[model samples]
Target: MRFIIQRDHLVQSVQDVMKAVTSRTTIPILTGIKIVATEEGVTLTGSDSDISIESFIPKEEDDKEIVEIKQPGAIVLQARFFSEMVKKLPSDFVEIEVQNHLQTVIRSGNSEFDLIGLDAEEYPQLPQIEEENVFRIPTDLLKAMIRQTSFAVSTSETRPILTGVNWKVENNELYCIATDSHRLALRKAKIEMETPANYNVVIPGKSLNELSKILADNNEQIEIVITENQVLFKAKHLLFFSRLLEGNYPDTSRLIPNESKTEIVLHTKEFLHAIDRASLLAREGKNNVVKFSTIGDGVLEISSNTPEVGKVVEELKGVSVDGEELKISFSAKYMMDALKAIEGNEIKILFTGAMRPFVIYPINDDSTLQLILPVRTY
Candidate 1:
């Protein structure tokens, strides 16, 4: 393959595709990126069995030439070295050529480097997913959904299913839920489709996190196609594929309480800051637990005490506090994480009891909910 391409465009594409390349792959070729030059454009692909990303640079866009192809060919180069070299190339354009025996030449400005390339034919083929069950979502919204929910996925491998985000689509609405048994995040958005579609799938949190970083924040619709075992996300000039986690995701609907014994409305920032300060001392404790209590009308006290460390006590006046008097203890880290993920100035928290899991969300928004299982400290 031989091509002279805009360095900036190539650098961006290489960085995006490298997210899927892993050095620990059992297949040796998986560690390198496959580069293919065609009359239409140049395509770069990287994969590590679980996830695959492909980036395409068109020969011409909007009547402007982005790539000048001298000869159409394909080769695979070490992903880590190639990506690093492209970023440091000191020129506006980069020229790449492939010669006999898979030898590759890279040049820009006054610098030139020769690299041994692997045959593209040895790379594993990405699954060709039929767009039979396809849906569309705006890129920006998809990124927001992933950011809001993926953080709560379990990091433990004891329950492999909890390490992923559970996605469900029904009644023209898409829902994403993640939980690590101690805390849960749920987000929902409405979607439009030509035909009625329903699905329940578990996608690895790591994959969603990587895909979010590659997507640009825009209103452009991203096409998604899901098969029994694989899911494909198609963006402008980019394609991402991930293998779905095998096994059924546990049913999380029943975990959310339908009623509450105590409810409080408070400013999100104020509550978040109070917890942050209290955690300063709580972090020294065994469980990093903070205590919350409703002292009087619309008055709440947050306190943390570690025998070895000093105690911290802060008072926060809520917008509204009603229902029975309550005192609950929970992990300061969990509360802070939930508060940051929720979007709104004012938040409403519903507590069923001192020991039951409590739900937090925006005051007027029902689309997003965060639940934390309170620590059993009275």
Candidate 2:
């Protein structure tokens, strides 16, 4: 392929696609990025079987020429070297040309480098997901949903299904839930679509995390399509594909409690900071556990103790306290994560009992909820 392209466009496209390329990939061609130049524009593709990302740079945008294609062709170049080289190129434009035997030359501003390229034909094709049952969501809301739930996914692969977030859409409502058995995050939103459809799929937390990072903080709508084994996210001039985890995600609905023994309304930031300070001592303990207790008269106490380390106790006055007073112990990290995910100044926490899982959510908002399974300390 022979093309002269703007340096800024080239760098951004390379970085976007590079998210899918992993050096640990077994496939030789997957280590490189496939570059194709056509009459329309230049397309860059990167994949590692599990995930694929494609970015397209138009030849001309807004009546300005971004790329001048001398000859339309395709080649694969090592991702690591090519990405690094493109960033350091000292010019506003970069010229790339391919000669016989897949040899490629890059030149920019008094500097030139030759790189051995791989045949683009050998690269694995990305999954062709039919665009049926597609739905759209605002980019910023999608990012928030991912942030609130993906963190709750299990890091251990013991129960592979827990490593992903469960996404369910039914009757124009989308619900996302993630849990690692110890803590759970749930968020729900209403969506409008031309044709109503229902779907339940498990998306890898890692994939959602990467996609969130790539998406800009905007209100632009992002098209999403889900198939039996693959999911596709389409944005302006970009396409992302992720392989679905095979297996039924456990039913999490039954885990949320219907009743509470104690309920407290407190400030989100106050609770979060208390847990952060208490965790400092809990971190030296075996399970990083923090103890929370409701002392009477709308007063709450947070404390942590480790025999080898010191103990800490802090008091927080709640806005409202009702039901029976109780003491519960839970992972400090889990509580902090739940607190940060919730959006609002004041939060309501519902405790079923000292041992059962407790739910936390923004006051006056039922759309988002966080549940934590209290640690048992005798």
Candidate 3:
């Protein structure tokens, strides 16, 4: 295989595909990236069994030649060395050629490198997903959904199911939920689909996080295809696939309380900042716990105490406190995460009781909800 390509386009594609390549794969060829040069364009693929990425660079786009393929062939080269070489090449263009016996050579302005390549036939094939069950979503909205929920996925591997985010689609609405038992983050958005279908799939948090990072903030729409065990995300010339985790995600609908004993409406920024400062002292404490207590008419007190580091007390003014006045303790980290995820300026906190899990969300938006389990503070 031989091809000459533009430097910037190749660099970007390499960086994206490299996200799926792992150095510790049991299959030796998985550490390399498969490059296929055809009459249409040059395709690069990277995979590690759980995830796979394919990037295509067309031979010519908009009358400008991006890739010129002299011979149609395929080769697999070490991702680590090849990506680094291409990025550091001291020119605006790169030329790659694969010779007999899987020997590959890359050349640029005043620099050239040779790498031992493997037969592309040994690389695992990417999962084939049918296009029947496909939908499109704006890139920005998809990224927002991922940011709002992926963080809440359980980091513990003991419950493999909890380490992934649950995605459910029905009636033109898409819902994403993630939980670590102590807290939950949920986001919903309206989407367009060609056919009506219901899908409940659990995708690894790690995979979603990577996908979010790769998706740009442009107004372009991304196509998503869901199959029995794999989900494919296609944006422009890039395609990403991830294997779905098998098992029934725990039913979390019942965990959200139906009633509240106390409710408070506060400015999002003010409350976030107060908790940020309070957490400093709480971090020095045993459990990083912060306490919130409602005072007379529209006043809320935020405090944290540590035996060795003393305590911090701050009053956030001009907040509406309704229902029974109550004090509750919760992880400062959890509260800050929930606050950052909210998009509105004002937020409402609903507490069923001092010990029950409290919910936080925007004042008017019911589509997104964050729940945090209170921490016991003696």
Clashes of each: 0, 0, 0
lDDT of each: 0.95, 0.94, 0.93
In candidate 3, which residue pairs get closer than 3 Å at backbone N, Cα or C atoms, i.e. clash?
none
Candidate 3: worst-modelled 10 consecutive residues by lDDT:
316-325
Question: For candidate 2, what is the lDDT?
Answer: 0.94
| TM per candidate | 0.99, 0.99, 0.98
Task: Report how far residue 145 has shifted in candidate 2, in Å.
Answer: 0.4
How many steric clashes does model 3 contain? 0
lDDT of 1 by residue, 69-177 (tens): 9999999999989999999999999999999999999999999999999999998999988887778999999998999999999999999999999999999899999
Model 2: per-residue Cα lDDT over 118-221, one tens digit each = 99988888898888788999999999999999999999999999999999999999999999999999999987677899999999999999999899899999
Q: Give the true-structure RMSD of model 2.
A: 0.8
Please identify which of the two predictions, 1 or 3, would achieve the higher TM-score against the true structure: 1
lDDT score, candidate 2, position 104: 99
Q: Show the lowest summed lDDT stretch of 10 residues, model 2.
A: 188-197
